[model samples]
Target: MYHYTDFDRQFIHQRAAQYRDQLERNLRGELKDDEFRPLRLQNGWYVQRYAPMLRVAVPYGELSSRQLRVLSKIARDYDQPSAAVYAHASATQAELGTPHLPVGHGHFSTRQNVQFNWIPLDKSADVMDLLAKVDLHGIQTSGNCIRNITSDALAGIAPDEDIDPRPYAEIMRQWSTLHPEFAHLPRKFKIAITGAEEDRAATAWHDVGLHLRRNALGQIGFKVLVGGGMGRTPVIASTLREFLPWDQILNYLEAVVRVYNRFGRRDNLYKARIKILVKAEGQRFVDEVEAEFAQIVAHDGGQHTIPQAELARVSKHFLPPALVQPAQAATTNIAFEFTDKEAADYQRWLHQNVHAHKNPALRAVTLSFKRLGFAPGDATADQLCAAADLADRFSAGEVRVTHEQNLLLPWVQATDLPALWLAARSLGVAKANIGLLTDMITCPGGDFCALANARSIPLAAGIAERYQDLDELFDIGPVDLHISGCMNSCGHHHTGHIGVLGVDKDGREWYQVSLGGSDGSSLSGEAVPGKVIGPSFAASEVTDVVEALLDTYRAQRLAGEPFIASVRRLGLAPFKQAANAVRHETRDGGQVLHVHLSTVDAATD
Candidate 1:
């Protein structure tokens, strides 16, 4: 866990004070909406569909229990819609055929951000003050600026790590934060980094991705990728540099963004991402970046080159906390026996939720937030505080927000598995569905987001409703069932094994189903975008269609093949035919319609 320095604390408190002034001025009518909009967005405030939304950045998904408690406080105190706002929002959603909107909860994103959907504008300053108290703020979480830097959730603890990428990610976080030159790019830019051989961070789908590795001479370097993104157009980033010295990463990153800032599209919002620029220019874009890098080095001597001492300073902050020190831990060789039924349940939980840690005595455990009723990744105020207490009791007072929308306790002793499992189960977060179908990656859809065409929460619920049988889920095996409200791909639906994108067809919600996409994880193999099967399915037909695709795989798959492998080996023809066969019109009020058709809700648990 990285501790905040005096400079960091001072900087954010000052920012909080400034935001208070700006917010007060806007409320007084001295600053109009247009002027206040950009200012608010810069601070991660958004005027969403029915209310103001706040996105709080959790750098690389790391959090201290104290910070989690503060987030819990914010959710309990500020994440509420006004009476009028709630009434209007409820009526609007009723017409849309979605479930009643839930409030006073924090939704964790695939990017490792916590979003509060119902916070009022007047209290935004108060929320900022609360966040600043814990050294948390929403800086650059929105707008055409470099967003929060994301990395592998198990960055410092992974067994396969070549170099812990946290220090480097922290370095970039410092460099990119409020950089005046790149403050207003053509559009939002994103970066992901990973030090492990496995691509758990999904770096291939980011604007700029870095893979940390050691060179032949044992010096650290990075393998860089540029232009990968998902939306209307999905691309796996091209290799920009095979090996960039670790020290010069900031300088090289500067050149890459510099070239993009100079040439990226401004006229068309649709074509504004760096992916478009890299695709349009191809080798020329790469060459231009290289030339810029040369110029930066030759003319200015690469002022951003990181020094060894500075790296050491940043690395020390990320070192394992005292609670994880093996010598200080209690050790015993006696193995506790379990009852047969207990053994069966505990083994399943261990297999699904526990991951290997570099430390032999330690294990990384994911607390499943995905269950019936609640939206995936959503934690209520009480749940958030419970998680904080769990972190304090079992995980060295630190919990990590995973990109898959779960909280990971990274320092649990292997011997404490039984006790932790019991505690997490009591907390209702031990669902044993880490990479299962029920553990779907989803975004707050039309119910909350103004940009969405459909609702994802209930759709996710609908799908989850059908998979209540743990035996059936484990039998089907690990699946990345990702959903997005729109083509924005905020849910990374483009890279899901089964990708579902919500679209508006004549003011009705329809879903496009795609197959054979992957996020480049070891389980998912090399990165590739999914291909749509056929015409978009009506919302009513989506759940049946998803079942049809899986049925198709089960019917055709070879022995021991997973869903993704079956999709690749069998091709999309049979799956397409099966999915299309399930599409049929449903009549509501004697009118042909694709109803929102969600079966799960906030009360489903």
Candidate 2:
């Protein structure tokens, strides 16, 4: 993990002081809501459905044990103490003339983001001061700027990855942070980097996705994807440049951002993303702009190539920890006996959570969030503290955050698996579903987010509850059920095997179902929904629909067919028919509408 330097410390402290004064002015009524909105956004504070929400940037999703402890402390002291209790109950009670809802403010771990809800804006500067003292800051968490650059969280530890992408991601972070050229872009931009062969980072749906690989000549290079984004107009990025050498990466990226900033629409906030620009102007125009910018930068003596001294400086910060001899051999613990049921549960967790590291004796263990009857990506203060303790004891004080919104201990010894799992279970972090269907990637939807049209976390929990039988889910094979509350696609619905997108139709929340979309090296573009299922059922009914869809896929699939493959082969008709049948039969007096199959046979036809 990268530690903050003295310069970083001073910069954050100064920024905090400035924000304190702004807060005072706003409280004094000198600044109206409209006037204070930009300032609050820049400081990562938003007036959400509750009190206030503060999104903290976990750059590249890496956190030290100390940082995790700081977050835990913040959750306990400043935010809501309980996992699901509301912070501004008094205010809500006063406004509504009734009792407040019992809901807790918890931490939400996104693919490459962490958000803390129910913050007090007036006291936020004090919180910022505490964070700065711990060498943590929230500088670019929001605003119309380049957001936190995300990379594969299992970068160096994943067995199938080509290289560690954190170093490059950090380099990009420093260059893009407060860059004057892009600070005034039409809308927020996101960048993702992936080193793994499997697309865990959802790179295909980012504004810029950098797939890192070594060339045949033994030189580092990147496959650049541009114009990939999710919103009202979802478009899977096209390969803009294949095999861009290491030295030319930054210059090329600069060209891309510059083109979007210059030509991307600003008249309509809804259509301001780079995807809209790519669609309206076509790839040829985007290519021309890139070429023009590249030529100009090249004429200036290639100023954007990472300087040798800077590269060396940043590389030293990311050096792997000193290698340690394993305390015990991998096979020595194979036949070890355990009497306690918790111990046996720990053993089962080890089988699912642990992964092989580059070092033969060491393993990378995942902490899954897919426990039955809990919302994915949520952690309480005590759980966070417990995770920090486990990291310190078993993983050399380092913790990783995954793109699936799970935590990772990247350097656990194979012999320590049982002990680590025991500690994890105590903290509610031990779940035996890493890549399984229940280990879904989700977002905070209508429950908290003001922009969300429907509730996503509840929907995810409902789906997990329906598939509570681990044996049944395992037999079904790998299937991603991603739900996004809105078109922003925060949950990455476009890439799931069974994608559910929430929408608002005539002021009522409904879901649109899509199938056969994938996030991988060989990308599948967004699949349009076969039907718009009206919102009329209780929470349990939603899960029933998912169950029907899964059963339909199982019945229709051929041997060795994955969920995505089956959906692609049979189209969305069969799944739609099955889901409607289940809805009608399971719930009496419920109507099942026949969804039209417009392009069902297009793949074969």
Candidate 3:
């Protein structure tokens, strides 16, 4: 919601121009691939499996309708590979048993970023120019530097928010964007913040997590958690500080990142995360960070300390944008009347997708991008434009990209919910499946990412195709079913109640299933990594394995217990047995391995 100043506009345009020159030099052969690699990464361009991937940052998941339209334009005009590349990709997909690989579409990522997988590297400069015109860029969205700063999607508008975190996030954005000090750290760094009591942002899974809250005297400050991350090692962040005055947040962050820069591993890419360092050093790491903070305040004079005037300047930009509502808008319950079947569907959507806003007259509504045919989070260019149109009509020209890979209209007038729902339903995005099993968080695995060991999209598709009945989903209840291509955790599989991870075994695709992971929600209880059930299963058995796990839960759970609660209550023994029971071996002449409880538990253990 922050409007760009003239200086900001000029700065972005110059960056675009600079990138154009660099791209030109690289294309002319003056800059070699190795020389151009870091420069291209600085601008958020990556050479993925088949084509270039552009990661466009939606700052704290906020986007204007104008920006959305620009994104739609990019998807329509430029999100395509060359004919030869397309032909080869199609052939590859055909071999993989997936025909019609899509083009001219975009994916919403778990970190609240938008990704275009078909953009050509040669045409990237032109795309950068278009992004500059709309005050959007992908800078700091990639590379080993600090990536996008993420926060709760309902930052300022949440009913339980203690303070609007957008201002702080914006300030940090300005402070960290291309900082010479942290331009190249050991590995990618991430920070997530939340102001609400409920942990919607999954702050505990970030490298640096901040909780904006008040002390006993009502003085605002931050509860800082450091070294939390997911990869080979999943770690809940250690508390760096119980409370640091809000004014010194920037200063404290400086100290924390400075320590990581000095000590974090640079030799091995696999063990380079701050989580690894924190785990290895333990208390020593905490002592080092505190000492660094003391040094920054004493010797550095806390140059990054935020002044009240500066904070106010940023805070005013995030105030509710102009939203006009009916004079007598319904504040209690929706007043829409419908026939029996119609009313049942509308009530399901209202209960699942509509969320309370701080303003009594406004509501936040999520447009479900999870449906049949298309992969989760994949939206075509036409759908993007349609979403922009819906935002313009209902949300005061603003839309939010949520961490769940869906678009949220944060300014929907409470009384206009009926009309908005009708329009969204027409777009086929009103599945009323928010938090349900079908609303999975998935990544474009081996299909697009070169780093992926196996494909994630088709697995997600298979599961979705199997569970089309709304009654079944409602019965299963809220569960985070996250899938990832590899250890990068792009789809955040480690935090899912039922985690699906794609891996490569003997040059063939295999999947490992994990259970009981939580993302630190009130429903999840705490942020914890899931435990593996048993040996990796063949791709053919994954769906059956999931069915077996769910079946075990269904048979054993107490009345009305959610899937995650059941998995927690009855340890992993029953689920592991269930998962292995139906797992038919595809290797060694298709022999079946009968698994007993002792062998199953021992295999996983």
Residues 401-511, model 1: lDDT tens digits: 999999999988888888888889888999888999999999887777777777778779889999988898998998999999888888788999999999988777878
Cα lDDT, all candidates: 0.88, 0.72, 0.87
Candidate 3 ranges beyond 4 A from true positions: 324-337, 585-605
Task: Give lDDT tens digits, candidate 2, residues 293-342.
Answer: 56957696767788778767777877667656655447414544567765
What global local distance difference test value does model 1 have?
A: 0.88
Give lDDT: candidate 3, residue 108: 90
Candidate 2 to native Cα RMSD, angstroms: 6.3
Work out the TM-score per prediction.
0.95, 0.89, 0.95
lDDT of model 1 at residue 136? 99
Over the full model, what C-alpha lDDT does candidate 3 score relative to the true structure? 0.87
Choose 1 or 2, whichever is better by lDDT.
1
In model 3, pairs of residues that clash are none
Q: What's the candidate order when arranged by decreasing lDDT?
A: 1, 3, 2
